[model samples]
Target: MVEDGASYWRRNLLIVWISQFLSLMGFSFSLPFSPFFIRDALGVSADSQVKMYAALATASSALALAVMSPLWGILADRYGRKPMLLRANFAGAIIVALMGMSPNITAFIALRMLQGLFTGTMSAAMTLMACCAPRNRQGLTLGALSAAVYSGDMTGQFIGGLLVEWYGFRQAFLYSGMAIGMSGLLVLLLVREDFQRPAPVIKTAETARNWHFKLGIVLSCLPLYILLMMSAFARSVDGSQFALFVEFLNGGVNEAGAARWTGRAAAAGCIGAMLSGLLIGRLLDYFRPSRVARTAALGAMLAMALIAIVPVHMLGMERVALDIGAFGLYFHDQAAPAVLALVPLRFMMIFFSAGLEPVMNVWLSKITPASQKGIVFGFAVTWRSIGWIFGPLAGGTISMLWGVEAIYVVGPFFFLALVPMIGWVLRKIRSRLES
Candidate 1:
């Protein structure tokens, strides 16, 4: 018989929550401001070139992540999820530090690919929590865990902006790397996992079909995979292009000024995501995960479309000034009309789209057989990587051709497409349950 899922779940969940917070904070410190890094540190300065390179940088990391997530997931299943978490943290610590000292753009992009190959503390933590948490409380536990992600990103962006402004990009990266290393140490010392190996199957002629059996796991959940990928794609189209959009709105006049504002805007979105993570968890506990996800997608779609059409100078946003305190430490300029209009929409889009991954995770965990959890979550990461890959490249292409603002115009179509795909997956899930 399987052991009790709740025996050590609460303690383990708390440890994982704290560790992932540190890990993601380290990530956001450098990544959210990479466009500036590419322009300032790596010496690539043409407006269009910066946008393309930034997208390329993001897509490179995602490509490596797409390639390696499944292998890591399989290893997690075989060894233990905690080990995977430790591995991700420690490896990320080294790679990210190196990114700070990169000699050229090529080296930075290469390290990013390595970053994807080694780090995914979030997936590892989620898989561990899913396996350990009590069945009835999984939604609550996972929701709390998702909150860690957004909260950490929020905290990191808030502080990282100031850190970058105060120190330099290199210092921020070094600091973030140290923080990730600390997360690994926490997991190593605190979290405990009582991993039970899958029971061995009888050796028979069916052995030749091993690959086929694993492929079946993916095929059965193809629709869910598609929904997750599409959702990821929708979010990326906006996010991967945001830093450049900030520069565009401010007319590319000030670097430090743009960085500070970008951080504030990103932090606002994370606030929305943190709220979404918690609220969706509560809603998921009482409602169908699929239904909740659909509602969120609809909200995300509307918000994104509104962002594209909203009046840039409406509601007196120019007069909404920051509270004065740190003279010379912060920018004294008034908020741009476009920037002001987009921030709320950014929060709304993030609030809704942020619900997609966790809701999909909760839904997948519920529907999947226990034995398939590791591989499924791994594949989930892999599929989402496809979105990451296209999202950045697509953003770059749009910004190059039509303009940065046009990226938002095209974002809604992805969400609109996601609606039907999710409904189709829901139908398939119901049919499987009935049968």
Candidate 2:
């Protein structure tokens, strides 16, 4: 049974939340401004050129994330999550700071790639939370984490924009690094890891030949890449057309007005994200996690499709239309939190599966061999990293060739593709377990 919120709010919870909240604030400060930095500060204004640069940065960083995520997961499994947490926090803090020192866009992307390699703070935090929290309350714990993370992100976005407007982009980057570094220091001092038994070693040849093993790994990794692809596609479209959308709203208004409108739309999306965190846990409890996730995907696809079909003029006048559409986007974004509720325990494994750390933990705990947890998670992150590579490239290509609406129209079909694949895998998994 799920525990009451009050009951689940324990000492460990506070520790994890506080540390994550701090780290995330630093991360949030840099996110929105990164694109702007590339576009305005660095002076890369061509649409296709910007898309290519974004893809390069995204793919490179994700590639690094892909390589390191599972390695860290495996190490944490072999040793303890506390060490991983400290490594990720302190190391990531340094990386973020260094990224601020990049002399050019080329250097910035390189530093970001390094950041991806070291950015397992979330993975480690989830591992700690999973070990500390009761099984029934996994969703709630993760939900709180999600809320804190998003709050940090929102705060960062708000402040980063102000800082950029005032002191300039470089100063904003420095400020972000300092904020994250302080949080990393706090984590080093506060977080503790409880030791666990080592994962059993598995023969690579036997696991490779085992169809069930291969199937499970494939199932765990594929959907995640697709989701990444969809998200990248969506974000790129929005990024590419943000100015156009704002101008359209302001009747082809001035640059300043367009900037303000863009900010408003982004803030609306953030608000939607916050609301999703609040409600997604309850929704997951009310339905199967898979169902909740699928529904969210459907809602997202529908919103994108509708946005493509519905005239923008209608959107501005109909407040309810904007509300519903915005809610759909928020719901889509909540897929990870909702699915994490049902993930099996090791917690980090869901990172392999695509729902971030919470769901990854749940899934990993259930299927990962007691002795081979580290290797399994490491491999999983590697496969998911492949998604990071393809997702952005596909998003960029599709948007360029077919237009933004085409990307949305095609995304739902991508989600639909997952249904049969996931169903088949689940059936195979069930049979293997029952046998």
TM-score of each: 0.93, 0.73
Instruction: Give candidate 2 regions above 4 Å deviation.
Output: 1-9, 196-254, 257-264, 282-287, 310-361, 366-380, 402-406, 430-435
Angstrom error at residue 363, model 1? 1.4
Q: lDDT of each structure?
A: 0.83, 0.55
| TM-score result, candidate 2 | 0.73
After superposition of all CA atoms, the RMSD between model 1 and the true structure is 2.9
**Candidate 1 weakest ten by summed lDDT:** 311-320
The TM-score measured for candidate 1 stands at: 0.93
